[model samples]
Target chain A: MPVLEVDHLSKDFGKGRVVDDISFHVEAGEIVGLLGPNGAGKSTTIHMLLGFIDPTAGTIRIFGKSLRRNREDIFARLNMASPYAGFPNRLTVFENLMIYARLYGVAERAAKIRNLLGRLGIEELETKQMLELSFGEIARVRLAKAFLNDPQLLLLDEALGGLDPYAATLAKDVLTQLQREHGTAILYTSHNMVDVEEMCSRVIFLRRGRIIAMGGPTEVTRAILREDRKKPALSEAFIHASRGEPHAVE
Target chain B: MRLNRIAAVIERHVYDAKHNLERVTDTLYWPVMDIIVWGFLTLFLARHGNLRPGLISFLLGAAILWGMFRAFQRDLAVSFLAEVWSHNVIGLLATPLTLREYLSGLLAINLLKAIVGTAAAALVALLFYSYDFFPYLIALLPFIFVLMIFGLAVGILVTGLIVRYTTKIQSFTWSITGLIMPFSCVFYPVSALPGWMQPLALALPTTQAFEGLRQVVAGGGFSWERLWAGLALDGVYLLAAVASFDALFRSARVRGLLVRIE
Candidate 1:
């Protein structure tokens, strides 16, 4: 069974529809990229999946339970990391993690927090306040918090954004190792096409609140350049696809 | 509704208070200052024999009770504001912590602040004016409970508005109780208000509480009827506040304000 399933999700904000009818699922141990430009409803979709926003229509099922009916049960098996949201600025890194650990009811919390700090290579940042940490450090600490519960499914919304190349690479590596070791499913969103190409086994492209395309990176890349015979980068294809341009010759 | 989740939220705020000296000082400053300032005024009035008998006790009691009300109101609103300022609301809502648990945690925080502020104010009152509020503890309990419920109700309503509207109306968090204080008749009898305002003053639970406090300080017969009336009114206000909070919360979710509100 898929670890995450979103079916026919739609959200209307009275001004207009922000997320039109959309559907997708993430299987265990799979990394799926949600690719889109800004305002393409990537964040909106993630928000819905996390139950932050109530969908005007459709359903979300996690671990075979309806999200609307069994939110706590579903949330117990999933966690999310975002560069947009943050921990309390006044709290030290360790304090932030400890609080989240207790909230999620993680047993052996001290040992788990210590292990996550070491795993994320943020042991030195334990005492640092969130406001004092660099953007990269904040992202790393958030990732550590996300992994605190050993979530079965992880929703990463632009989790790699704002990091330097080295930090991004380190984050990606840790995510990969964590996924492999724990068989955690990840629904990763990013504008970094290179990271998407390297890490995502399958990509779901959204544009104007609709999925323009979905498939393996190689398959979608081939589909994007099928008629042109020129193997443009995923970023180029993404730009073209987002513009509603045809990938194949008629 | 989970104990661990509620404790976790409270723990975060406690840690925040521990780390932020400004927050600690802000909580302590008002009650202590009010006592000192009012204590001196009462002393001068008594020294000159300018005040009526029992007026000093009245002033000190009002100050301490008002401090309790303010503490409850401010702590609840600040708890919500803290989440907004830190951009932690999204993270919190995304977790298993339900809105009910979140409010419970805020109430728990308010209780802690109420205890500290009330005790500090009471202690200052005892030392500065020789006014002992402790003997009236049993009488004050219901009054304090009514004030707390009303304050919490207002705090929830204000927090809900701030969440739905973002920081545009954020000033309501602290200013709202001040706006209600006049109607509450904290320092005077409801009859002292203008004839036009008496009905409105009588409608407030705080008015009933303060009036009851005055009666207790005057050594008059305690009015159980007044306490019951205040509690019943508080129940109505509490229900309305919870409804307002729920409505605003739903609207916030629908508008995607929770994630977008900084």
Candidate 2:
């Protein structure tokens, strides 16, 4: 069974439809990239999935339970990291994670926090308060917190946006391993097409609240790469894709 | 509700308070300041020797109890504000933590702060004015308990507004209580209110609790009627507040109101 199943999801803000009818799912161990330019309703969709906002229409089922009926239980089995969310500023890294660990009822919280910080290559940052850390460091801390819960489904909503190249690569590798070893399904978003191309097995593209393309990375990339097979870079195709010239695929 | 999750949330905010100077001032500094200023007022009034018998006790006792009530309500609203201010609402409500568990955690922390704030205020009253605040508290425990519950009810209603409108309504936190204090009769009998407002004062649970406090201190014995009325009012107000808060919270999710002001 898929870890997440979203069907006919739509959201309307005032007279405008932000997330028009959409359907997608993520299977265990699958990494699906959700791509679009700003105002494509990507964040709204993530917010709906996170239960931060409610969908005006459609159903979302996670781990075989209806999201509307079983929100709290579903939240336990999934986690997300967004550059938008933050811990209390005065709290140390370890302190923030420790609270989340306890909230999730993770045993041996101190040890788990230490291990996750090490995995993200920031074990030395455990004692630093949020205000004392740079933006990149705070991003790393968010990733560590997301991974702390051993979530069955992980959502990344531009979670690595603030990271430098080296840190992003390291975090990406750690995320890949988490999926490979734990079979944790990930629905990811990023403006960095290179990272999405390298990490996502499949990609779902959204333009103005509709999925313009959905398939294996190469298949969708090729659909838009009609004239230039030489430039296999997903970024080049993304430029055409976001410009309102979309190519649909299976 | 899950105990562990609630415990964790309490731990989170307690840690937040330790590192936050503003929180320290809210929980301790302001409550103690109220007592110091009010205690001096009572002292100055007593020097004229025209004050009614047991009037100093009424004044000082009310100051300590009023401080506790205000501290409890302020802490509750401020804790919600803390989550809103830090943009940590996603980190919290998005977790396995049920809304009841989350609220329970908030209640626990404020309760702890009220207890600690009460103790500090009482200690200060003892050291500065030689006023034994604890004995009066022990004697008036039931009335005081009812008064604090009313405060919780008001706090819950205000916190619901914050959830619906975000911090735009935060002015209600400090201002609403100040507006209600006159009706509560914390410094005077319910009869002291203007004749037109006396009906309003009688309707408030705090007024009854305060009046009951005065009746007991005046050797008039316990007011079982006041205790029962206060409890009944608290139950209704609390239920209404909780239901309204639940509705507002659901509305916020639907309206995408929790989207910012992190």
Candidate 3:
């Protein structure tokens, strides 16, 4: 069964629609990429999934429960992480994660925080205040917090944007391991086409507030490159998606 | 509404207070300073005229209670502001924590801070000025309760506005209490205001609370009518504030205002 199902969801700000009737689902252990250029409504979709904003139309169900009606229950089973958000500047990394651990109702909080930090290769940061860390280190802390609950469904919005190449690779590894071990479904959005192609089992491409393409990375590339004999990279498909040219619908 | 979630938020705030010097000074240092400055002024006045007995008790008690009002109001506002400033509000909202659980934690922390700050100030007064507020506490409990409730209500209202209107809401944190101080007659009687302002002042629960505080300070027992009136106003104001917060929160979510907290 799908861990998350967002059906015909739409969002408008005043006269401007941001996410227009986009729908998708993430089954357990599947990592679905939400790919879009700037203002293509990827973040808006994530915001709606997190229940940070209300959708103008349609519904979002997680674990077969309505997000509007069972937000707390659904939220407890899921988590979101973004590089744009940080821990309290005055708090140590451990202190910050401890609060989330309790809020997420994770048992064995110490073990979880320690293990997560170790897995993220930032265990030394446990005693450091947020203000004392670099943006990349803080990104790792966010990952620790996001996965501390052992979330069944995870939403990641540019969550790996600030990490270095090595850290990003490690972070991606940790994500897939969690998915493989615990069947944690993930919905991810990032501008890094290479990362998305590598990590996502399937991709959803959005342009001007709607999904323009949805399929496996290779299939999506092939779909966008229809009628052309040359197979192309995901980045090439990204360029085509951004150019707003007509492409074969998948 | 859940205890564990609420405790989690409070735990964050406690860690915040424990680590941040500014927050530490807010709960301890500033209250101590208020008592020290005001304690000296009362002595200066006592040397001038035949002051009412327990006059030090009166002024210091007012200061202590008023400090608590500020504590309740400012702590809630500032605590929420801390999250906004650190860009951590989204991190919190993304958790399993409900709105009721979040606000309950902040208010619970406010209550704890008010009690601790009030006690600290009172302790200084007892040690230095030899003025004990405990004797008057039972008599003044109802009035103090009203004032604290009003303070928390204002905090909630200001927080909602901040959530709705993003920038410049920080001004409300510092200036709101100052704006309400005169109308509250914090240092004076309601009759001290002009006749037109008297009715306006009396409409404030803080004004009534202070009046009752003064009555008890002068050895006059509190009037049931005034206490009930203050509580009624507090109830209405509290309900309105809660409703406004709920509406503003929903509107903010609809408009994606929460994501703009930073």
Candidate 4:
């Protein structure tokens, strides 16, 4: 069975639907990229999957258990890391990690904090408060937090938003390693297509809250090129697809 | 299940506060300043007349209680506001951390701030003013417990307002808490108030705390009626605050206002 199964999930905001009927699946050890431009409902879909927002209709299951009924159980095995999620500013980096580790109910918190800090190459900066860290370090600390529980299913919402090219590449390698070594199923979101093309095994294209395309990145890119002579790059393919261009339908 | 979640949140706040020692001090600083400045000013004003030894002591005790209360309200409201201002609330929302967890964590932090602030005020009063610490110290725990609950209720109400309305209201919380004066009977005996003002002043939960503290410290016995009244009134306020928080959070989720800073 797939590690995650999202079935016809829909969420409405006020009078309009922000995340329309959407469905997908992720097998263990698979890295899936949720790609979309701003306001494409990528975050909304992720939020619903994480049980942050209730769906207007449909079901989501993790490890074959219903998310609605077993959210705490599912959440115990799952974790999300994003720099955008606020950490207490006055707390030191060590303190921030320790707090999350405890919340995730990680045993032997001291060792866990030390191991994760070392893993993230942030051991030296442990004592520094969060406000003192550079943006890149903060991003890396968030990444550390996500994997703190040794999560089986990791949802990374714009996980690499602030990293430089080298750091972003290192993060990608870490994600790849996490999957290969631990069988972690990752749902990655990013605007950077090159990273998506390199890191993801499969791609899900969202346009105004609907999944427009899903397949291997190479296969989708090739198909888009074959169908649209005007656009050559995957970025252009994304815009063309979102605009309801006729070529994207195929 | 509900209790488990609440405990999880409380644990998170304890952890956060433990690592962030600077924040605890930062939270208590302004309130400490309020005590130093206002405590002296009230003394100076009352010195010209008969400063009832018991009344003056009551005023000092009320200042200490009020300081802790403001410390809690300001700290919790500002902590939540800081998250909102920095645009990080949305990020926390995406995690397994529920709204209740977030609110509970902040509330715990506020409670801790009240304890620390009260302690600091007592220490300072002891060292600087040659004040008798025994009665004040004995009354400290119960006084702070009631005052913290009252402060938390105000904090939740203010936080709910901040989430739904503009952040401009955040500044008003401290000023209004300071303004809870005449009703609290911080400066004079409740009996000294005009006939009609007596019931009105006595209705405030903090007034009961002031009266009870004086009865215990100077009058030589604990006032059961005042203690129970304070707890009951403050309990109702806390329930109202929690209800308002629930409503605000539900509307915020629908309007997407919880994560919106401006």
RMSD of each: 2.1, 1.7, 1.8, 4.2
Question: Which residue pairs clash in candidate 4?
Answer: A85-B91
For candidate 2, lDDT tens digit of each residue in A178-238?
8888899999999998888888888888888888778777766776655535434678778
The DockQ figures for the candidates are 0.77, 0.79, 0.78, 0.30
Better of 1 and 3 by DockQ: 3
The DockQ score of candidate 3 comes to 0.78
The residue-level lDDT of candidate 1 at A241 comes to: 75
Candidate 1 residue spans exceeding 4 A from truth: A228-232, A247-250
Model 3's CAPRI class is medium
lDDT of each: 0.86, 0.85, 0.88, 0.74
Candidate 3 chain A minimal-lDDT segment of 10 residues: A224-233
Ranked candidates, highest TM-score first: 2, 3, 1, 4
Model 4: reference contacts kept, as a fraction: 0.29
Worst 10 residues of 4 chain A by lDDT: A223-232
Highest-scoring model, DockQ: 2
**Candidate 2: clashing pairs of residues:** B87-B262
TM-score of every prediction relative to native: 0.95, 0.96, 0.95, 0.83
Clashes of each: 0, 1, 0, 1
Worst 10 residues of 1 chain A by lDDT: A224-233
- What is the per-residue lDDT of model 2 for residues B69-121, given as tens digits with 9 covering 90 to 100? 88788788888888888788888877888878877898888888888887888
lDDT of 2: 0.85
Measured with DockQ on alpha carbons, how good is candidate 4? Answer: 0.30
Residue A163, model 4, lDDT: 88
